[model samples]
Target: MADVFDQIEWNVQKIFDGEPVCVHVGNAMECELKRHPSYPKFHTEAVRAGVQPASSSRLWESLIAMGRLSDLDGDCTWRLVILDCIIPSLRSVSARVSRDFRVDCEEIRSDMVATALEAWKDTATGVAPRNVRDRMVKAAFDAAFRQGKATSSERPMDDIEALSWQEPTAQDCKPRASSIIDVDDIRDADVAEQIRGERAGAMLQRWGCFDAVHSFHDEIRSGHRSGSAGQAVKTSRSRSLISNPNLYYYSSDLYPRHIGLSEAAGVMGIAESAAHRLIRTGQFPLPVARVGRSYKVSVRALMHFKDIPDAIIHVDDVENGALHARDAVP
Candidate 1:
């Protein structure tokens, strides 16, 4: 006796049982293509002949749409057909990503299938009707990748190597308007030693000390480097001050350059849990940075995303920030 999977898959194959094949579904589905009013053109064809609905790329969309209708009507033959249609693609994706995601190939395949099934429920009224099967496979791969990472025993790396220029051309060797580099530049001096002492360039960037070290490099290579570096820093600061001059009223050492998740929630007049929900769905303008167990929202990105000319952000008090306004988004 065949298992349920086999039985369902055999039923899907039966749809192609006519013409070059044989009649399996009989007159159950019209020989004339199914034109669903709620569905798009990608989901239908004017004439259905000499083509396998599941085998032909031009015809698969229509088949999937029809299958959805069948599923809703209490006959689940289309659900099986949809799974059979995407299995090969799922196999290929699971094979390619299993190693990177550190999950067994079969496990990855199972996860992908589960994701596909969940996504399947939305096919009838999904945002986009085109490229249904292809998107399903991609969605499955993404879901599997996330699940693999969450379950994997491995931890993320803390350090990353600095990027190096490859095969420098004459144009690359030419000095830029910013800073000059010498053979015996900061590479052989205190700057190099300090840089080496830091965990990694990536870590240094995260700690916000990258610029100070970079300024030292400029100072060493260009004897008057401090002038240029200071001017550049001042120019950047001036841009922000154009709208809000009191940005640095509180000492930089005392305050962080981000809005705490709780503070952001208070500003938005929503509960923290509600704020989290909005953040998860990307309904908020600011991109959230997860630091350990807490979240940090950058003030600059928040301001830019909301298109507000002036706002007090990254401050200790939410009442003094743009986040305090209920109209942050409109």
Candidate 2:
């Protein structure tokens, strides 16, 4: 337990590094300490030393009470009080994003902590009890998603270019033409190119070339209209690929499963209205994916609010021949 405490203290120092600690964050740390196996021993020792356990869940409260009992005193002890809370919350956010985006959790967590600390330091009073974690997580999520999209784009293009270089077979070269609009019908080349580019971008987006779609969008925004009429025609053909039910075939599988607002509220132990208020105020730790008029919450994201253990199962437990022992009398 001393080793565990020492490790935790070291990790906390690495996280905060002399930053001012917030009370809520301190309380979070106390809760984390309570989860440790040695906490009961520490608590019993404190009881013997005439320190009453505080009713409040605040870590600072517990630490102050215990500190008085242990005869151990220091400003460093007080400084680390809130780190238990902040580190876990940041870690939870990182884990959720990493799972969703299939990125490295530790990398994201480090970046988020750096961003949060910088933002925290920039504040006039150097205190942000509520918004700090949310802002850090959101920024981290955006960066991770962008990286995932960019990576996805690069792999497919390599395969596509390789396939394009192959000699066309009789079947491959066969005319598979759709209804073609006459170029004579269009007057302005720029207008034609813009229309075509938009269509191509939409098609790229549907095909999950999100980065390519973004690149095309940037080109359009930058007003580069130097391409050939064939390019315009290609753009026109591609741009009209609007997302239909068929287009979103894998969206359900690709996207994370989301719970309703009621479920989210229940998990947080708050009223539905309060949950809605938090979302409306932009203070919610996780972002709500808008599904039409309703907001859908991620179950993974909700896990961040609670102390749940990893859902792993071991194979050795059922090896005792309990299958044969069952219903022996029946």
Model 1, 169: alpha-carbon shift in Å?
Answer: 30
Clashing pairs in 1: 17-22
lDDT of prediction 1: 0.44
Query: How well does candidate 1 score on lDDT at residue 109?
Result: 68
In angstroms, the error of model 1 at 196 is 11
**lDDT of each prediction vs. the true structure?**
0.44, 0.39
Each candidate structure's count of clashing pairs: 1, 11
Residue 276, candidate 1: how far off, in angstroms? 32
RMSD of candidates 1 onward, in order: 17.6, 19.9
Candidate 2 lDDT, 24-120, residue by residue in tens? 2243355543343233343344223221122322443444443233334434453233333334334444554454445665565555545544553
